[model samples]
Target: MHLSVENLTFGYGSKPILKGVRIDGIGAGKVAAIIGPNAAGKSTLFKCLAGILKGTGNIFYDGRPIEAFRREEITKHVTYLPQEGASNAVLTVFEAILLARQFSVSWRVSDDDLVTVSETMEALEIADFALRYLNELSGGQRQMVSIAQALVRNPDVLLMDEPTNSLDLQRQLEVLSIVRKATKAKGMTTLIALHDLNLASRYADQFVVMSDGMVYASGRAESVLTPQMLEDIYGVHAEVSIDSHGQTVVTPMCSARNRIANRRPEYAQLAV
Candidate 1:
C-alpha cells in the first residue's frame, strides 16, 4: 500500500519539468496532495506515479518498481482519474460508466460485475441518472461519473488530476469530501493534484509543493501552505487565513507591493 518515488525526473524534449524529484515515503492510509501553480508539472508527476508517462527515476509500490509493471498490471493496482477532457466526445454517463469495465469482457456482464456497477452508481449518487448520457448531464455530474469510472477498478492507490476543475463550490467540496471519505473507508491510498491550497490544507494529510521543476517544499499541509510558498509558486499575493468556523480561505490581493510588504524576508521578491 506504500508509494515510493525516488529521483524522478521528466520532460518533453528540451525543457525539463522535473529535476531529481524524490518522495521516498508515504504511509499506507493517508491522503497526499500535490500542489503547485499552473504549468508546474503537477499532472506530469501524477502521470509518472500512475505509469502513464515515462520518467528517469524508480517508483516503487509496496516493493516492486512501477516501471517494470505492465499497463494492465499497473491499472489493477493504481487507479488514475484523468482530467475532464474525455467528455468532449459524445457519450452518455451510463455508457461511460459501463465502458469503465471494458477490461473485463466483450459479450456479457457477470453478476459480480453488475453488482459493482450498481454499487458505484449508487455510491456516487448517480443512480437516478443511470440512463442519462454524458452531454445530457451537468459538468458537476459528469465529473462525478468520471470519478466513478476510476473507482470501478478499486485499486490500491487512487490518483486524481485536478478532478475539481470546472466545478462549483458546493460540488467541489462534495466531490473532494467524497474522495477523502471513500478512500479512507476502503483503506486505499490517495494522491490528488490540487490547485487550491486552502482546500488541501483542510483535507490533505500531506502536501508536496512543486516549483521550478522540483519539489520546493513538502510535509504536512500547514507547513507547506504558508503565504510565502503561495507567492513563490504563484506571482500573485494571497493571504491564507482561517475563518471562525476553521475553514481556510485564500484571499488574493491584486497589488504586488502589498504582498511584498507582507511576505517573509527570505521571499521578499515575491512582491513582483
Candidate 2:
C-alpha cells in the first residue's frame, strides 16, 4: 500500500497548527520518520492520519481517499500508538492486549485470541508482565505493552507518535528493530514521529522533516539530513556524516546562535 497526504490542514479551535502539509511516496513495507522541533505539528499530523483529529485536505491509502471509510473500517487497516503509555485502566497487561484484538474477534474470544496475545507479548519480551496491572508497570514497561497492543492488531498502516519516549538506549534499539522487522514482514506502511535524529537516521527508510506548519524536507536520510537542513529546521550546528557501516550519523556541536557568535565576535552579544 502507498500513503499520501495532500494539502492537509488542521488546528485547535482557532489556532492553526498545520497548514497545507503535503507528503507523498510512502510505500508499503517502509518506515517513515516524521522529525521536527517541538510544537512543529508532527503529532498533529499523525492524529489526522489516524482519524482521531479530522483535517481539511485529503489522505489517500492505496489511491483511495480515507475519508470514505467508517471508524470500524479504518480500524481494520490502521492502528495508532500515542506518545505516552500511561493508562488509567485497571486491566492487566494480558487483558489489555486481548482487548486490542476485540474489534476483529467475534463476540467471545477463542483460544486463538489468547495464543496470539501471548505470542505478541513474548515477541516484545513482555510475557513476564502479562498479569501485571497497566498502572503498576514502569513507564518503559507500559510503553512496551502499548507497542505489543498495536502489533497485535495487525494493521496495514501503523502510526506511532514518539514511540520510544520512555525507553532506555538498549530498549530503544530493540523496540525500533522489532518495529522495523514487523513493518517489512507484514508489508505495513509505518509512520513514526520522533525527536531523536540519530535514531531516525538509523531506522527510517524515508524522512519527513516538519518545520513551523509545513514539510521542510522529505526524502532519504542522506538527502534530507544535511547540515544546512539541520541548522534550518532544528537551529543546531550539526555534522552529518556516513559511518563505517554506511549509516548516517548526526553529531550536534552547538546551537546555531553559538556557532555564529563564535565565528563573528562582534555578534556575540546577539547569541544571548
Candidate 3:
C-alpha cells in the first residue's frame, strides 16, 4: 500500500502547524524520514496520518480516503510511537509489550499474541529486560520497551517520532536496523521523524524535509539534503557530500545569520 497526503493543513486556534503540505510516493516496505528544523510539524503530520488528530486534507491509503476507514480499522492498521510517553506505568517490560498486543486480541490472550510479543522484544534486543519494571529502567531502556510495544502490533503503517531519542549511538543504530528489517519483511510503510540528518540518509528510502509547516523538499537524500537547502531551511552553512558508500553526509560549518535571504520560493517546488 501507498500513503499520500495532499493539501494537508492543521493549526491551533489561528496559528497553523501544517500549511497545505503534499507528500507522495510513500509505498509499502519503504521507510520515509520526516526531517526538518524544530517545530516543523513532523510530529503533527504523523498524528494526522495515524488518525490521532483530525486535520484538513485528503489522506489516501492505496487511493482510498483516510475517512473511509472506521476507527477500529485505523487502529488495526496504523501504529504510532510518539516522541514521549508515560514511562511510569507500573508494568514490567514483558507485560507492557503484551498489553500493546492485547489491543488487537480478545480478553483472553492467545498463543499468537504471546509469541508475537516475545519475537518483537527479541528483535529489538530488549528480551533480557522482560522481567524489569518500566519505572526502574533507564530512559533508553524505556524507549526500547516502547518500540517493542509498537512493533508487536504488526501494523501496516508505522509512524515513529524520534524512535532514537535517549538511545546511545550503538542502540540507535541497532534499533533502526531492526525497524528497517521489520518494515521490509512485513511490507509496512514506515515514517520516522529524525533530527540526525546522517542517520536519516542512511536508513530512509525517501526524505520529506519540512520547514515552517510546509514541505520544503521531498525526494531522495542526495536531492533533498543539499547545502543550499540546508542553509535555506535550517539557516546552517553546511557542506553536503556523498561518502565512499554513497551516503549523504551533512557537515554544518556555521550558521548563516542572514537566513531570510536564503528562503527562496523555488525550493518549495522541489519534490520526487
lDDT of 2 by residue, 69-139 (tens): 89888888999998866476999999998898877445588898889899888888999978989988988
TM-score of 2: 0.95
Error of 2 at 264 (Å): 4.9
Instruction: Extract clashing residue pairs from model 2.
Output: none
Question: Roughly what TM-score does model 1 have, to 2 decimal places?
Answer: 0.86
Q: At residue 134, give the lDDT of candidate 3.
A: 90
Off by over 4 Å in 1: 88-91, 104-108, 242-249, 255-272
Tell me the whole-model lDDT of each prediction, alpha carbons only.
0.79, 0.90, 0.90
Q: Global lDDT for candidate 3? A: 0.90
lDDT accuracy of residue 112 in candidate 2: 86
Q: Clashes per prediction?
A: 4, 0, 0
Candidate 3, superposed: residue stretches over 4 Å from native? 258-272
